[model samples]
Target chain A: MYAELTRRSAWHDVLPTVLGYIGIGVAFGIVSRAAGLSILVTLATSTFVYAGSAQFVLVTMLVEHSPLLSIVLSVFLVNARMMLMSTTLSTYFKQEPLWKNILLGTFLTDESFALGMNKLNYTDRKLNFTWFNTVNLASYLTWIVGTALGAMLGSLITDPTKFGFGFAVTAMFIGLLYLQIISDKTISLKLQLTIILFVLILTYFGMAFIPGNLLILVVTLLGCALGVILKHAHN
Target chain B: MPTIKFIFWTIFCTGLATWLTRITPFVLLKKFTLPPAVIEFLNFVPITIMAALWFQQIFIQQSGQLPAIDYLNLCASLPTVISAVISKNLLVIVVVGIISAAFFNIVL
Candidate 1:
């Protein structure tokens, strides 16, 4: 049964996820090291937090010697999307054992969530915690390994910023967006446009007065609300 | 304040904040099933969130200046988009983006 599920997963879908984790994981490690964090801290965050955007936000704030409030707020803002991710998984995996659901929910990063949803659609099977665990095992391992490598060699590798290492995360998002676009053109376009506008407005506000993290929260909530309206109107 | 105090506060706040946010959905959803309307809305959440993130990374200004166009980023991103469209290969897209970004950075 396990082998069959692995075989059923489109390697094409899994490949982007793995590449994304590696690239983004390395970026986080480099930034963490540059922030003066020990390798242990770097690995701990990557392993425990397991959320790329949040890790980056936390490390960046720590580097600036921002107050504890800022670090907490930044991570919360970046990871607010997890609320949505876990909600969807809950509905899909509703019948699964409670313990398993909680375990899988903790591992629900962006790529894993996307992959899990896609797998569910392709297989037309109920996604239990077991399937989630299998897919997430690969993701978690890659992320930890990539982050550790980056932490160890980050200082040696000069000019990470100059190399556009930062864009690795963006590129991964774009690639994932492209996949969404191809999968469902109409809805994805609308969602993409709305988010672009929201970001532009939020960034403007963030630059003007509000903190960056607060701006992110405001924009994301607004976007989520708008998306709900659009979905309802369409239906 | 001492550095140790700062670290302690950072860890405390970070840990608390992380735990609260992580637990919110699980706790809420366990008791109640989300309505279909909510579920449908959530479908679009990831796409929008990611778009916002990508936009900030690609377009946001670094220095304290008006949004000056980074022609290099634009040039690099344009080709990256093309490569993504043509090849649809993650590795190829990454290579193209990196090379283009590097080339433009050197030239400009």
Candidate 2:
């Protein structure tokens, strides 16, 4: 394990995520601090919870003084995507010890998972436990560090939106999705685009009545079922 | 004012919930083999999830109200999406997004 950690640094593998996470973590810290959270509370949430999007939700809920139960439910709903990602990435670790897999669970953000999935799809190399741990730990620490910085300087950055920091993760996701689609040979680009368009329409039309997270969960589930049916029909 | 006790409780609840979601599949699916169709579906699920994420960011939806297009977001995102298509690099796309957003803010 120590050898793999020193082999190549593998820093390049997680460099992009590091950049995005810093911006996001700072934005999160700014928001949390702006919401009147002390620096200690902001750091505590960022360090312990570490769900990027859910952290945003927590800040908003804190501002509103929302009930604890609803806040927990909101966190669960937003982070449920991790369940899907964790399950999908599980087979990649069949050879590793259970403790390693459990340890890896700490670093499973969307960007890291996308990077991992892309690595799996586009490369011939096997998933190295050390490499993933490095990626996970580096990204995780970057987020915490950025949050600390932001919380420390939160009063200075009174307006994060003016710098368009809000769109950072969206852009990252778009880039990841674009890479995933272009690199994937198993799925047709046409089919994938179709699903995207379908989901966008559903989201735009239904978001008025449904919560965004809940709507996404439902749409993804139904769309996947439909995708499977279509795949069979085409075959 | 929110009390210190309430805030800590909220944090603990959220931390526990998020950890549960992350740990559930890892612990439960060790012996299970997912069906091939389910696997096929999972392949396409990411696209839907990504689409929802992008659309959620791009649109402005008030609670219990019709969604409206945020033209500024659309304008800012256009270049980033284009860069994503042409470059397919995360760093480049993010730079393009931030620059374009700033540019749009200035020009429009």
Candidate 3:
């Protein structure tokens, strides 16, 4: 069943994420410091809150004097997609022990979940705990450390975009999407490309009307549904 | 600095909310049994999610009218795609993309 799963070492699957998290983590730290968050608070946020965008929103909304309830709502809305991801991830992790699933769930971020799914899904990668935890713990620890470094380096490294750090996450996504399509022989190249085009069009059209978080859910549901329908028809 | 109580509260609430969204589904759904079709559908989620995230980053939305393309990102994507196709390596594509960003940033 897992013949194609262990093609590469765990480090190979995780290095890009580890590197990108460090860079983004630094940026997050710098932003928190600039927003007047103390180093302890910054560490606590990254350690406890963990979700990158939500942490950024928490910092911004706090600065903007949004009420605590509103901040919680905003954070919830921003991270609602994680609910979908966590559900999808459960398809794989459901068999694990309760504590393991909970621990894995705690560490599941957008990057780890997406990367794991890309391989574990269309391709047959056996995502063992050893491998999965390596990706999660390494990325998590580095993110915390990187935020600490960025908080300390605050003024020295202003304007992270100057070094092109801004594009690292996007670049990683692009690369992963490319790999996801290219490696999967389960579906035809034509259908994979068609699905990509279909999802892009849906996202593009929905951008102006729908909110980012909700729009993603809508597009993902519609796009993947159509993809499955087309695949069945193709068969 | 913001007041200590405020910081602690925000951190506690935001962290809790984020954790729930992230952890609840696994805890909640693991108990139930899903049908096969739904499982098949979940397989398709990753690609669409990836595409959505890529789109949001690639194009910057203007409050009104069509969204404008970030030309720098567009230009950098060419090399990144090429590296993805050629090397099939994450490190290679990301490095290519970052380098492309630096190069385009200087020129554009």
Best candidate according to lDDT? 3
Model 3 per-residue lDDT tens digits across residues A1-235: 1224443555677788776787789999999999888889989999999988778888998888888998888888878878888888887777788788888888888888877866665445556666666677878998999899899998787777667777788788898888888776666779878888998787777777777557777888888898889989978
Candidate 2 segments exceeding 4 Å error: A1-9
What is the C-alpha lDDT profile of model 3 across B1-108, one tens digit per residue? 567899899889888888878888888877997788887787778788888888777777765456678788888888988988998888887888788888899999
State which candidate, 1 or 2, has the greater TM-score.
2
Off by over 4 Å in 1: A1-12, A60-70, A117-128, A185-210, A231-235, B1-16, B61-73, B89-91
Clashing pairs in 1: none
User: Could you give candidate 2's per-residue lDDT for residues B58-105 as a string of tens digits?
Assistant: 788878988988776789888988998888777888778777876777
Per-model CA lDDT versus the true structure: 0.66, 0.78, 0.80
Error of model 2, residue A101, in angstroms: 1.5
Q: Work out candidate 3's RMSD over C-alphas.
A: 2.4
- In model 2, the Cα lDDT at residue B12 comes to 84
DockQ of predicted candidate 3: 0.71
Report clash pairs, candidate 2: none
Reference contacts preserved by each model: 0.36, 0.65, 0.69
